[model samples]
Target: MKFFNEESDFFGLTKLKERFYSSDHDGLSEADREYINRIKGQNPFGIISMFIGGVSFAFGPIYVAFPIITIIFCFLTCGTFDREKEDNPWTFIIGFCLALIGLFMYLRGVVHELIV
Candidate 1:
Protein backbone atom coordinates (compact mmCIF):
# COMPACT_ATOMS: atom_id res chain seq x y z
CA MET A 1 0.00 0.00 0.00
CA LYS A 2 1.12 3.52 -0.69
CA PHE A 3 1.22 5.03 2.75
CA PHE A 4 2.76 8.31 1.56
CA ASN A 5 2.97 9.83 -1.87
CA GLU A 6 6.19 11.28 -3.35
CA GLU A 7 5.62 14.75 -1.96
CA SER A 8 5.24 13.42 1.53
CA ASP A 9 8.82 12.20 1.64
CA PHE A 10 10.10 15.24 -0.20
CA PHE A 11 8.44 17.80 2.06
CA GLY A 12 9.12 15.87 5.24
CA LEU A 13 12.07 13.50 5.18
CA THR A 14 13.98 14.89 2.20
CA LYS A 15 14.06 18.41 3.58
CA LEU A 16 15.20 17.13 6.94
CA LYS A 17 17.93 15.03 5.30
CA GLU A 18 19.14 17.98 3.30
CA ARG A 19 19.28 20.18 6.39
CA PHE A 20 21.37 17.60 8.21
CA TYR A 21 23.90 17.07 5.45
CA SER A 22 24.13 20.50 3.82
CA SER A 23 26.36 22.45 6.20
CA ASP A 24 29.09 24.77 4.90
CA HIS A 25 32.48 23.50 5.99
CA ASP A 26 35.55 24.65 4.09
CA GLY A 27 38.33 25.80 6.42
CA LEU A 28 36.36 24.74 9.45
CA SER A 29 37.44 21.59 11.31
CA GLU A 30 35.25 18.54 11.80
CA ALA A 31 34.10 19.71 15.24
CA ASP A 32 33.14 23.13 13.95
CA ARG A 33 31.21 21.59 11.08
CA GLU A 34 29.36 19.36 13.47
CA TYR A 35 28.56 22.28 15.74
CA ILE A 36 27.23 24.39 12.88
CA ASN A 37 25.16 21.53 11.54
CA ARG A 38 23.59 21.08 14.95
CA ILE A 39 22.03 24.52 14.84
CA LYS A 40 19.05 25.31 12.60
CA GLY A 41 16.64 28.14 11.96
CA GLN A 42 12.90 27.96 12.33
CA ASN A 43 10.84 27.04 9.29
CA PRO A 44 9.17 30.17 8.01
CA PHE A 45 6.35 28.24 6.41
CA GLY A 46 5.37 26.69 9.71
CA ILE A 47 5.21 30.06 11.40
CA ILE A 48 3.03 31.45 8.67
CA SER A 49 0.67 28.50 8.74
CA MET A 50 0.20 28.77 12.47
CA PHE A 51 -0.57 32.45 12.26
CA ILE A 52 -2.98 32.07 9.37
CA GLY A 53 -4.63 29.06 10.92
CA GLY A 54 -5.13 30.92 14.18
CA VAL A 55 -6.71 33.80 12.35
CA SER A 56 -8.91 31.51 10.33
CA PHE A 57 -10.15 29.85 13.49
CA ALA A 58 -11.67 33.14 14.56
CA PHE A 59 -14.03 32.90 11.58
CA GLY A 60 -15.93 30.01 13.15
CA PRO A 61 -16.79 26.39 12.16
CA ILE A 62 -17.17 27.02 8.47
CA TYR A 63 -13.37 27.27 8.25
CA VAL A 64 -12.44 24.27 10.31
CA ALA A 65 -9.92 23.08 7.75
CA PHE A 66 -7.56 25.89 8.66
CA PRO A 67 -6.79 24.57 12.09
CA ILE A 68 -6.19 21.10 10.69
CA ILE A 69 -3.76 22.54 8.21
CA THR A 70 -2.00 24.31 11.04
CA ILE A 71 -1.62 21.03 12.90
CA ILE A 72 -0.16 19.39 9.80
CA PHE A 73 2.28 22.23 9.34
CA CYS A 74 3.26 21.96 12.96
CA PHE A 75 4.15 18.28 12.46
CA LEU A 76 5.98 18.93 9.21
CA THR A 77 8.08 21.62 10.83
CA CYS A 78 8.74 19.72 13.99
CA GLY A 79 12.27 19.08 12.73
CA THR A 80 13.16 22.74 13.14
CA PHE A 81 12.91 22.51 16.91
CA ASP A 82 15.81 20.08 17.18
CA ARG A 83 18.31 22.92 17.05
CA GLU A 84 19.63 24.94 19.97
CA LYS A 85 17.14 27.82 19.66
CA GLU A 86 14.89 29.17 16.97
CA ASP A 87 15.23 32.66 15.60
CA ASN A 88 12.60 35.08 16.91
CA PRO A 89 11.41 32.49 19.35
CA TRP A 90 8.49 34.67 20.28
CA THR A 91 6.91 34.28 16.88
CA PHE A 92 6.76 30.57 17.15
CA ILE A 93 5.64 30.81 20.77
CA ILE A 94 2.85 33.18 19.98
CA GLY A 95 1.93 31.31 16.84
CA PHE A 96 1.82 28.07 18.74
CA CYS A 97 -0.38 29.55 21.43
CA LEU A 98 -2.70 30.97 18.84
CA ALA A 99 -2.86 27.64 17.09
CA LEU A 100 -3.93 26.00 20.33
CA ILE A 101 -6.54 28.63 20.91
CA GLY A 102 -7.77 28.14 17.38
CA LEU A 103 -8.00 24.42 17.88
CA PHE A 104 -9.95 24.84 21.08
CA MET A 105 -12.26 27.32 19.43
CA TYR A 106 -12.88 24.93 16.59
CA LEU A 107 -13.61 22.08 18.97
CA ARG A 108 -15.92 24.12 21.10
CA GLY A 109 -17.81 25.17 18.03
CA VAL A 110 -18.15 21.55 16.96
CA VAL A 111 -19.43 20.44 20.34
CA HIS A 112 -21.93 23.25 20.42
CA GLU A 113 -23.38 22.10 17.11
CA LEU A 114 -23.60 18.49 18.30
CA ILE A 115 -25.30 19.44 21.55
CA VAL A 116 -27.70 21.95 20.05
Candidate 2:
Protein backbone atom coordinates (compact mmCIF):
# COMPACT_ATOMS: atom_id res chain seq x y z
CA MET A 1 0.00 0.00 0.00
CA LYS A 2 1.17 3.50 -0.86
CA PHE A 3 0.50 6.55 1.29
CA PHE A 4 1.14 10.19 0.60
CA ASN A 5 1.53 13.04 3.06
CA GLU A 6 2.54 15.65 0.53
CA GLU A 7 1.80 19.23 1.49
CA SER A 8 -0.62 20.98 -0.79
CA ASP A 9 -2.74 24.11 -0.96
CA PHE A 10 -6.14 22.82 -1.87
CA PHE A 11 -9.47 24.61 -1.56
CA GLY A 12 -8.51 26.07 1.83
CA LEU A 13 -9.00 22.62 3.32
CA THR A 14 -5.27 22.22 3.92
CA LYS A 15 -5.32 24.89 6.60
CA LEU A 16 -8.00 23.06 8.50
CA LYS A 17 -6.36 19.62 8.28
CA GLU A 18 -2.70 20.60 8.37
CA ARG A 19 -2.11 18.58 11.50
CA PHE A 20 -3.28 15.36 9.83
CA TYR A 21 -0.38 15.38 7.35
CA SER A 22 3.31 14.96 8.14
CA SER A 23 6.62 14.38 6.31
CA ASP A 24 7.28 10.93 7.78
CA HIS A 25 4.56 9.03 5.97
CA ASP A 26 6.84 6.98 3.76
CA GLY A 27 8.54 3.58 4.43
CA LEU A 28 6.02 2.60 7.06
CA SER A 29 4.25 -0.78 6.96
CA GLU A 30 0.63 -1.03 5.93
CA ALA A 31 -0.53 -1.46 9.50
CA ASP A 32 1.48 1.48 10.76
CA ARG A 33 0.23 3.64 7.91
CA GLU A 34 -3.33 2.68 8.59
CA TYR A 35 -2.89 3.19 12.29
CA ILE A 36 -1.53 6.68 11.83
CA ASN A 37 -4.11 7.47 9.21
CA ARG A 38 -7.26 6.28 10.94
CA ILE A 39 -6.41 6.27 14.62
CA LYS A 40 -3.52 8.64 15.51
CA GLY A 41 -4.03 10.99 12.59
CA GLN A 42 -2.70 14.09 14.27
CA ASN A 43 -1.87 15.88 17.49
CA PRO A 44 -5.03 17.94 17.66
CA PHE A 45 -4.32 19.37 21.08
CA GLY A 46 -2.00 22.05 19.65
CA ILE A 47 -4.63 23.42 17.38
CA ILE A 48 -7.25 23.18 20.08
CA SER A 49 -4.87 25.00 22.43
CA MET A 50 -4.26 27.73 19.86
CA PHE A 51 -7.96 28.47 19.44
CA ILE A 52 -8.79 28.29 23.11
CA GLY A 53 -5.69 30.31 24.03
CA GLY A 54 -6.76 33.04 21.65
CA VAL A 55 -10.20 33.16 23.18
CA SER A 56 -8.85 32.85 26.70
CA PHE A 57 -7.52 36.39 26.52
CA ALA A 58 -11.02 37.74 26.09
CA PHE A 59 -12.26 35.39 28.78
CA GLY A 60 -9.43 36.29 31.16
CA PRO A 61 -11.61 38.29 33.46
CA ILE A 62 -14.49 35.81 33.38
CA TYR A 63 -13.06 32.32 32.83
CA VAL A 64 -9.72 31.88 34.58
CA ALA A 65 -9.70 28.13 34.03
CA PHE A 66 -9.57 28.46 30.24
CA PRO A 67 -5.97 29.67 30.17
CA ILE A 68 -4.99 26.87 32.50
CA ILE A 69 -6.51 24.33 30.17
CA THR A 70 -4.76 25.86 27.18
CA ILE A 71 -1.40 25.80 28.94
CA ILE A 72 -1.81 22.14 29.80
CA PHE A 73 -2.53 21.22 26.20
CA CYS A 74 0.55 23.05 24.95
CA PHE A 75 2.82 21.24 27.39
CA LEU A 76 1.40 17.83 26.56
CA THR A 77 2.13 18.10 22.82
CA CYS A 78 5.51 17.39 21.18
CA GLY A 79 5.50 20.74 19.51
CA THR A 80 9.13 21.41 18.70
CA PHE A 81 9.96 22.54 15.18
CA ASP A 82 11.48 19.67 13.21
CA ARG A 83 14.26 21.49 11.44
CA GLU A 84 15.66 18.33 9.85
CA LYS A 85 12.37 17.87 8.00
CA GLU A 86 11.77 21.58 7.61
CA ASP A 87 8.45 21.44 9.41
CA ASN A 88 7.23 24.42 11.36
CA PRO A 89 4.90 23.15 14.02
CA TRP A 90 4.19 26.49 15.62
CA THR A 91 0.79 25.94 17.15
CA PHE A 92 2.22 24.98 20.56
CA ILE A 93 4.39 28.05 20.89
CA ILE A 94 1.64 30.40 19.82
CA GLY A 95 -0.80 28.71 22.14
CA PHE A 96 1.62 28.78 25.04
CA CYS A 97 2.29 32.50 24.66
CA LEU A 98 -1.38 33.33 24.32
CA ALA A 99 -2.26 31.20 27.31
CA LEU A 100 0.40 32.90 29.41
CA ILE A 101 -0.83 36.31 28.37
CA GLY A 102 -4.36 35.34 29.21
CA LEU A 103 -3.30 33.96 32.55
CA PHE A 104 -1.36 37.11 33.34
CA MET A 105 -4.37 39.23 32.49
CA TYR A 106 -6.54 37.16 34.74
CA LEU A 107 -4.13 37.49 37.62
CA ARG A 108 -3.79 41.22 37.04
CA GLY A 109 -7.51 41.68 37.17
CA VAL A 110 -7.77 39.72 40.37
CA VAL A 111 -4.97 41.74 41.93
CA HIS A 112 -6.69 44.96 40.87
CA GLU A 113 -9.94 43.79 42.37
CA LEU A 114 -8.20 43.03 45.62
CA ILE A 115 -6.46 46.39 45.67
CA VAL A 116 -9.67 48.27 45.00
User: Which candidate number maximizes TM-score?
Assistant: 2
Off by over 4 Å in 2: 1-43, 79-86, 110-116
Instruction: Give the alpha carbon lDDT tens digit for every residue of 14-100 in model 1.
Output: 475456546566799889877875676655545675676556556434566666666666555544443354454455456556666
lDDT, candidate 1, at 101:
69
Which residue pairs collide, candidate 2? Answer: none
For all candidates, the clash counts are 0, 0
User: lDDT of all predictions, in order shown?
Assistant: 0.57, 0.60
Quote each prediction's TM-score: 0.47, 0.51
Q: What lDDT tens digits, residue by residue, belong to model 2 across residues 1-116?
A: 01112222323333544654555767889898776556532245456667887877667556789888877656544332233433345766787888788799887765235333
Q: What lDDT does candidate 2 reach at residue 75?
A: 59
| lDDT, model 2, position 14 | 39
Root-mean-square deviation of every model: 7.7, 12.2
Instruction: State the weakest 10-residue window (summed lDDT) of model 2.
Output: 1-10
